[model samples]
Target: MTASPPDNSAQMASPSYRLAVFDQDFLLSDSLRGVRFLLEFAKADLALKAWGVRSTVVVFGSARVRENGDPDHARWYAAAREFAALASQRGGAFLEGGPVRDNVIATGGGPGIMEAANRGAADVGAPSVGFNITLPHEQEPNAYSTPELTFRFHYFAMRKMHLAMRANALVVFPGGFGTLDELFEILTLRQTSKSPEIPVVLFDEGYWRGIINFDEMARRGMIAQKDLDLFGFAETADGVWQELVRRGLKPHEDLESLTKSP
Candidate 1:
């Protein structure tokens, strides 16, 4: 008994003995939720910085709309795809070897509209960002988002932060609750001046008006009539681009020319 050394296996195996960073159980504990949030923020932030993503055009739309679905769904899907392609080509996303990329297409990173936007960027051979979230049902990232630019997050707040931070414009397509949530989130930020003045364009005026009575909101005095100017409507992909430009979204070429000017 005297010759037998003290057994330290249990002590060595204790959770406390594990390195803090490598301790998955501890890291995922409720107490570390804030830390997890920071991690999510830092990871995406670092990736975007490395990729030279200076500004983004966030696209919010319905995940239920399918390209081969009903007439409305098909139309929305095609429009979303076309808008992404046009934006990627004309926006700074296609500018190579630049110090920063601007107006890059950004999406929620799911099927339907998200997929269409990402696919549109891919169609023109440009990089796009997909900010996917972890839902209870596990939403998957669309296939067309640039592999290196695609990201997943567990916190909606963090995901929204990334979406808003570098946005040069916001393009909203027809969608349901989730789409409305995102659209309002940006609109509120713009109204409160929490974020920069970015163009907000909604596709399908009839659809949006049918879904919500913005005029009624203004008439009720709930929202100021001037607040109605926070967004505009577009009917087609090209019209979306034109509306964004009209609302003060500067293209990459314009930015470059300005920088070079005296």
Candidate 2:
């Protein structure tokens, strides 16, 4: 019997034909990075829209914070949890089966203060969002976040965008670089008016003051004196809620009550 000829036609077929949207190998390829970016944004956006998350109260803080143990850790963790519950209860998160959920708590979706914030919303029977990122150390989403609303992203940029896009306010806790990075990203956006004005509250005035000398920045002309007004400090969870309200975050429930008032 003669040997069969080589299947050159099959070998010459375009690789694109074998490519599938769900194929990790193809999706992670350099040529498909842009497509992956779009997919990341679209998927999160679609899920958020379907869930009726009109606006969010973003919480940023140290993932190392603990609910119990060290006094400082316990304090920060407790405050984050309380703030989340307060935001949910008073920031329009507990709507009457509506499609326009507002001020829903959003977190980094890891442990520490992120977990506390999500837990707080859960305590109030409110749906919260978790924008988790894939990290080298295998960071996992906290159980307190709404399972259906939890999202995992490989791109930090996409995660940040989702966190910032619908934010009605940002409450930051004592943290290191990651926290600072996120805080400044929004601050820069607010400074330039690239995004709408949203109140930024940094919890624990002492911690923030020690880490950053805002007044010195103003004195050195690194930032305008008015820039110092961009964010306020809150020592307690109730204080944080009050500051947010003072900065003009009207709850959906309040809107109805205000309308009914003679």
Candidate 3:
């Protein structure tokens, strides 16, 4: 009997035959979640490193704030924008062709306060980072952040990691649940000594006090009195910068001088 031609079509068409790297279905599977996380971390990390971002001043606030909204919202947006501009100009982000960039303005990369902050940095001709995230409602990145530095992530944990890792300080503006979550995350990290000490400043003392009774928490033994000192309050953009300095956020000039000293 004559031998029939060998059949190889079935094997070639099998899913198992696809290359792992190119197989989106396999890569997105639960089994590859760790890899996905690593990818998320590495992409941003590499870009920041390439851009010489040694340190960042993280800005967090309500995405709902509008420049033309109610009085409180307008004030918050204006302050956030002003603060970012000031930080970028004096924090070494304006330095051109430097091997290390310090205290570059960074934000959540959404509308409202995030947009204001990014816009402020852009106003000063400085590069700013926008660590955006994938959300059910689709949060889009504002046009103000540096295009090269804007990044989007699928995981909040990874996004938060990037935000915290390079932060030399954190400035929080009036916000809601998301803002509160970020504020406490850093506070918890500092409280537990999981990260290096960095100054934390909340904009609009009245707003924060009204939203969360932190003093009550300390009085009720929910947190130590020292924990209450983890953050200070500021009313204006300039006050925010002053509070950050008072709380130990160093300026780029000081840092540069220190580097040159014997």
Q: Kindly give the number of clashing pairs for every candidate.
A: 0, 0, 0
Residue 82 in model 3: lDDT: 93
Q: How accurate is candidate 1 locally (lDDT)?
A: 0.94
Model 3 CA deviation exceeding 4 Å by range? 1-5, 258-262
- TM-score of structure candidate 3: 0.95
For model 2, the run of ten residues with the poorest summed lDDT: 10-19
For TM-score, the strongest prediction is 1
Q: Least accurate stretch of 10 residues (summed lDDT) in model 1?
A: 94-103
- Candidate 1 residue-wise lDDT, 1-262, digit = tens: 3588899999999999999999999999999999999999999899988988888999999999999999989999999999999999999896577788889999999999999999999999989999999998989899999998999999999999999999999999999999999999999999999988899999999999998999999999999999999999999999999999999999998877888999
> lDDT of model 3 at residue 100?
87
Error of 2 at 181 (Å): 0.6
Give the candidate number with the greatest lDDT.
1
lDDT of 3 by residue, 38-88 (tens): 999999999999988889999999999999999999999999999999988
| Root-mean-square deviation per candidate | 1.7, 3.4, 1.9
TM-score each candidate: 0.96, 0.91, 0.95
lDDT of 3 at 191: 99
